[model samples]
Target chain A: MSLSTVAGARLVARKDLRIEQHSRVALAQMLPFGMLVLILFAFALDPSRDVLTRATAGLFWMTVLFTSTLAVQRAFAVEVDDGALDSIRLSGISAASVFLGKVSALVIQLLVLEAVLALGVAILYNTDFGGWAMLVAVTLLSTIGMSAAGATYGVLVSRLRHSSTLLPLLLLPLLAPVLIAATKGSEVALGQEAGQSWSWVALLAVFAISYLVLGVVLYRPLLEET
Target chain B: MTTTFAPKIIGTSSPATRILGVLSIIGLIALVVFGLVISPADFELGETIRILYMHVPTVSVAYLAFIITGVGSVIYLWKRSEFWDLLAASAAEIGVLFFGLTIFNGMMWGKITWGVFWRWEPRLVTTTVLFITYIGYLVVRSIPTDTRTRGTVSAVIGIMAIVNIPITHKAVDWWRGLHQSSTIFATVDPDMRGTQLFSAYLGLTVFLVIFAWLLIHRFRVAWLSERARGIGLDEAIAARRAEGSFS
Candidate 1:
């Protein structure tokens, strides 16, 4: 809440954006990769056209989960690779602020990726968007929760030698609840006949806010750790 | 002859310690014999409820270990004590062991009860995930070269992973799970019998006692190893300083 904290967060966000802008490779790599996954799912499942209607929400969320993993890891990869971590810590800024800034940037990157994937699902599988507005709400909620928890764990575990292998192991299990709620929420928003799936949407919202608060508070100790 | 501060054994080995040991032994005996014999045959499950003797207790104990780990983590972080960190890590490692048994026993049970070895049942799925996360914690522990770093990082992870459990517990309510409902503990009904209820408590108490004993031993070992490693480092540094002074 301090001015310095806000400034620190802004500075960290700007720094990440600048890094992404320069290489732009991280952004470029995921789209084709994500599309390929979608292609594989389509070929593999071979669901009936009627089946696609019911399956769209699951398929859409699956795409987001995998693609977001790819996109999210890169958020910290660059900073860690260049030893910017130590410098950031030494800059007299709060670590929690840095975590907020990193999570914010991740949300932006994930939103972009999810947007593309959502469109892909819509075109490929005829995903209904009747209550599309709620879909967006669920998407945002799930994205924030996933990124906040993922980024916190990713940052803490990044220093491990086998982190690339371990990150998902640590992340996906925890992310399952978020995935379930979000998928169900999106289903309801898609106007599929389901009984009171709005409960899931509420859960997603609660989950996101909880993670946001928790990640901010817990980030300091983990940041100081590395 | 380990010079490490093991859990203190008061004037007469401590009443809590004696009681815990006796209870653990008796419970293990009951689990092996009484759980197999005295518990009535399930109308549906038959002899396989015998498997529940092991399978059910393993899952119950694993959960108990994790809860203790969570508590230990909170204490470790707050007090900044090596004792609490060691306790947490020991509990986590043992929890990992028990959780693995839980999954293993559950899979075998599932193969019989559910006609398949694995399904996306919320109970099994969540527990499996928790087990895997426990292994991930070990990986986290393996990464940090220093004791303090390892302990502290693992503590943070232990705490975070605990946050995942409530969701895991509620997975049955949230998803289309293949697992049966919690008969005894569900909001809709409580179906445990007098013996069944007694057995559950007996199992929990036994596991807690075993966990305490293991924690004390594991913490002692960890403390000693850390001390030994510290000595080695100090000697190496001293040798380097001597070389510098001679030069």
Candidate 2:
């Protein structure tokens, strides 16, 4: 019997999970990497509590942005190899669904990284951890937006020559608005009362949705042409 | 036989070309003389601001060329005509020239005004991005064969990046308005007694004519190059066919 939408997505997600089992490619070294970033941030920034307090949110988001790029860049590499991407397309599954699965997997990876990084920053920099819920929400939304934009640019340019360099150039500019909004959102969650933190969160939500839709719609044509 | 198309600014050897060439030359002479000798020094930046007569119009012309490239890109995608593709490529090639000039002039103005040649200010950053995007367009084209796919992709990206032009112009407004954003292109009042303004318009007209002349020449060059390659391929194929027939 054919699978329902939910069933199909779950099945595809499981297949990816199974593939990841042996390789353990996804989320590999994420915790340690996030720790490395936090340690680096400590050494780079002044040791003053005042400085750390102000720079924590920016530092956290920057870490996420860079780490997430590393994560998303590999999101499709496996499927692209061994002709699995073509097979997936031929599998009568929605590209959007597959995109969602990849994004979901990435979200899981990012959430883990963020949790560890935020905890480390909190313990080290004396962050209050008062807005943990808001931190989680912003992390989720921001990751979705970045991953969607990154994945779209990734798929579009992957077949091109020098795509590794091209992807960052194209993706970074598109990701700028997201990065700005999300960092502000995190600042709000951290109880740094710059007015309109919620507004920034709202903007992140809107951006996430826009990039999601753009990725889903553009994926079909982009993949077909490739 | 291969026919090479050379880009002409005002005219070829034709009489009409000679007439337009003469007119453009006279217009340029009058504009330059009026601008340098007749235009008054500015109240604020003084003599340095005189560069605006040349700088502003060149940037505007470059923007005009890019806008046309965007239009040509859209037309190519819609019509799937090589003509439109050639047109877009030509505009981009020439657009880069004018854009480079604009950036150069901007640096000169920046040095004189801000006392620095480069800054990460919104306007400057956006202009740099625009320059990079055009250079990317040219690089995308210059890659080895497979013009069909690469050309279409470049065209789509070109049209989409037009979204950047307005955004760049408005970056200051949207984020931080800087360096006197113009509300209207016609903001110059009749009170302005600088002959440079009038002379600038004359320069604009001459440049527009040059743009058209170059477009015609570029289109012909691309078409002939394609034809010359096709002829070379055809002769090789015919020679092979004759050999096969004898064998």
Candidate 3:
């Protein structure tokens, strides 16, 4: 809430984004992986049965979920390299600022991935983006939820040697509600069902807000341990 | 500070816990006999309903275990104590065990009733998520780290994961409605009567007592292992000093 906190968060976020721009790991490697996951899902599920069209929302969200892990891992891996995280901790910025900064960086990368995957789903699955606004709303809210949860778990496991493997196991179950809501909301947005998409959006918003708050409060303890 | 090599008894069960353990064994035997032999078959389910005795109790105990773990986690985080950390770890282990059993029994029950071993029913889905979350908690605890750090990390995970239970249940239910005919498997209904009610209560009580017994023993084991690790570290440091002297 403090001006300094906001300034600190912006500072951290810019640093992360600048590092990512230089390395381009997410853009070069993770983006293609997300696209490939979409293509693979098409192959795994029969197109002749119209299953791809019907399952497009679920598949697209699955791709995003899988790729977000990579983004999160990269986000924290950057900090671990050269003891950058220790320097950040010692720099006197609040832990909440650092958490917000990491969540923001991860969310930006995930939003890009989501955009690419949306195009892939549209082209390959031929999904009719009927409720386009609802779709975008759902995507943004769910991405925030995922990124917040992902960033928290990423930090929780950052100090462990086997964090890469442990991160998904720790995160995915916690995100099950997000997946369910986003997938269902996507279905409604695609006009596949007459059910309420807004309810799902509400759930996503609640999930996102809770994690954002939790990240701020818990980040201090997590930082202390590291 | 003077360092001693003696193996200190950091944790041990009291007479109360020993008595509870014995009582739980007796109660378990009685419940099994009642559920399997003494209780009459359900008018609807026949012999398959007997699985309820085990299934219901396992899930009940699993929930209890997780609640205890959550409480232990909160206390650990607030107080920063090793005892609470060990308690949380032990409860999570038992919780995971019972959660697995809950799924296994649910699968068997589903196979008989629904002609499939698995269904995305709300309770089943939520339990599956709970199982995986706690398994992750256990995995986090397994990573080699200082006790304080490990406890802090796992405590944070424990608190966060438990908060998801209700949300998961609601979301899964909204995504797909509960199975209509699973009334028996649903929480106890008011229409239930007589021996069936008795058996269910007996099973729940027996399992709870068993959980308590297991928790006490598991906590003691964790404490002993922690002490042993500290002693090992001390000895290694002493050996390094002696080697330096020889050089």
Best by DockQ: 3
Which RMSD does model 1 reach against the true structure? 4.4
Q: Scoring model 2 with DockQ, what do you get? A: 0.22
Candidate 3, after superposition: displacement of residue A161 in Å? Answer: 1.3
Scored by TM-score, the top model is 3
Model 2 regions lying over 4 Å from their true place: A1-22, A29-53, A93-117, A120-141, A184-217, B1-31, B69-78, B164-196, B199-210, B213-247
Candidate 3, A1-226: lDDT as tens digits: 3348888999898999999899999889999999999888877878553899988888888888899998999899988878898999889888999999998888888998898888888899887788888988999999999999988899888889799999999999999999999999999998897797798999899889988988898889899997
Clashing pairs in 1: none
For A1-226, candidate 2 gives per-residue lDDT tens digits of: 4445556656666776666666766447656777788778878888788888887888888788777777766666676767787887788877777666666667766777787788888888888766777776778888888777667666656667766666666666556656666766777777775555566666667778866775565565556655
Candidate closer to the true structure by TM-score (higher is better), 2 or 3? 3
TM-score for each of the candidates: 0.87, 0.75, 0.95
- The stretch of ten residues in a row with the least summed lDDT in candidate 1 chain B is B182-191
lDDT of 1 by residue, A152-213 (tens): 87787777677777788788877888888887788777777575766777777777777777
The lDDT of each candidate is 0.74, 0.68, 0.87
Error of 2 at A164 (Å): 1.8
Interface CA root-mean-square deviation for model 3: 0.9
Could you arrange the candidates by lDDT from highest to lowest? Answer: 3, 1, 2
lDDT of 1 by residue, B146-213 (tens): 66566667777787788778765664456763346532112211344655445555665666677776
The CAPRI-style docking tier of model 3 reads: high
